[model samples]
Target: MVLWENLQAVLAQRGVAGFGVTTAAPFPEMAARLEDAVASGRSAGLPFTFGDPATAADIRVSFPWASRLVVVATSYLPAAGSPGAGVPGRARIARFATRDHYRPLREALEAVAGLLTAAGHRAAVVSDDHRLVDRAAAVRAGVGWPGKSTLVLVPGAGPWVLLGSVVTDAELPVSEPMRRTCGTCVACLPACPTGAIVAPGMLDARRCLAAVLQSAGWIPLELRAAVGDRLYGCDDCLEACPPGDRALATATAEQGSVDVSRLLAMDDATLRAEFPHFYVPRNSGRWLRRNCLVVLGNTGGAAAIGVLAGYAGHRDSMLRGHAVWALGRIDDPRGRGVLTRVAASDPDAAVVAEAATALAGTLTG
Candidate 1:
């Protein structure tokens, strides 16, 4: 217990917002739940814990040398910054991702691991998309209850915290698990613009704008309109959650908005360098540009005409397809001119098809 007390002080000094411990037990409940989500296609293409539910749930299975699980939550942003605020010609990045919090979360976990190591115990730091059922561990460790948004909501801090875990063979005691629930508050359910939250505690990632943005392909046609100038990350649901309201930070318009046109003009390397925190698929700038096109499509309007036109003929067919979609979504006569050309002669079949659709919509709309 003395070592545990020292550990808490260590974590506090390191700026960890909250933490708890649970026996490194297999998360059987999480395994069952993940299997169900995966079977329903709700977990499709998700790169997080859903990848291997069984192994993720059972921390010991992957790290058989582990005997204790230490879960930690770090508030990356002091408050949720600029929620749902859209400035035309610009897009919003989720406050959680306005900067990377996971790195610090790992650092804190590593600090905790260091203490255990000094005590002659082996420790492993597992966090953020590393195959641990982190939320389950957090809940079991009394960190917080899972919010309706599928985030671990620490009291007062809400779900505006990042989660990480330290696995060790130490004999540290576990914290009593939290018994709270959102209790009938379904505020987060209807808050989602794309209806990603299907139930109080269930989220269908297939329709989640946040998940869609991180995913490696073109934005879904059905959800593109709802994206609403979001270049990366969608915070509609989290911002709407009442618990996180008190902690919401007022962001200057300049702080929250990214210029869609300017971002579209950035070459691949520049995009990666600017947003090392973003989960760009294969580190390709095309994916980031792909997202930029959707934002321009939704909010760029006439101001985005030039950038969209340039990308419509980009060497990457994927980018070309998304740019075509943006051109179609906009109502400018110049946009129409570009779409007509794309519809007639873009080499990619998908890009051509998108161009034709945009052209038809122009005629009928």
Candidate 2:
């Protein structure tokens, strides 16, 4: 018991915002919920969420002697006045991805695990890994309750905290689950631009702007408009919650708004170094460029049309299609000329179709 208390203190000193211990039991209910979600197509396009239910539900499967689970929350919120303010002609990234919180969270958990090992107990640390359903562990440990946005909402920190856990054989005292709930507050439901939140605690990843942005391939036309100027992740749902405002106020802003024009001009190496925390698919710059094109269409001025015109004949169908879309959105004479050329000569069927559709929209509008 004394060791557990000391471990908690150590985590706090190391900047872990909140933490709790719980029995390392399989999360049968969570597993069932995941299965149902997948069956309903709510988990569409997310490969990470489609593993064997039993494996994710049971920590003991990975660490057979596991008896206790220590779940920890780390706040990635930037300090006050750290440039989180929205910038016109720039893209907004989700709050959580502003910095690499996983590294520090892992270190803190490992430290706790070391203490357990020194006491003759085995330990395994996991953070942002696919091995366990981290949210379930946090909920069971009383670290926080799951918010409607599908984020673990810490008491004062709201949903701006990242979650991780340390599974061990130590028989530490367990914390009771939180009794709090979001209740009748449906703020996040209407706030989702793509209406991804179908229920109080349910989220459909297919329609989620954040999920779509992270996903590889072309952005679906229907959801493209709702994506707005967000280049990476969406924060509309979190921003709408009352508690979320407080969390933002206290969080240290780690990143400033991204300049879409600058991003479009960057090469692979430049993009990777500029946003190291971003999940750039296969270390390719095309994904970032793809997103930047969307932002350009949404917020760019006459200057953007010239920049976008360059990609009108891009070899990559995804880029060429999006470039056509941006050209149509800008609706400038130069952009129109490029679109006409792509519509007539682009070899890719998808790109040709998109160009024709975009050109038609321009003529009609």
TM-score of each: 0.95, 0.95
In order, the Cα lDDT scores of the candidates are 0.82, 0.81
Prediction 2 TM-score vs. true: 0.95
Candidate 1: tens digits of C-alpha lDDT, residues 1-365: 77899899999898777899999878788889898998899985675777788788888778888889999998755643563466778778887777675878888898999999998899988887546878888999999998888888887777788888889999898799888888878888888898888887788989988888888877778888898878778777777777777665533333556776777778789978988878867887777778888888887778889988998888989899988888888888999999999888988889899999988887788
Q: Highest lDDT: which candidate? A: 1
Q: Which parts of model 2 have CA positions greater than 4 angstroms off?
A: 80-88, 251-254
Question: Model 1 misses residue 257 by how many Å?
Answer: 2.5
Tens digit per residue, CA lDDT, model 2, 51-163: 66677888777788889999999876653223343455678777666666577778888899898888888888887666788898999999999888787888877777788
Error at 269, model 1, angstroms: 1.5
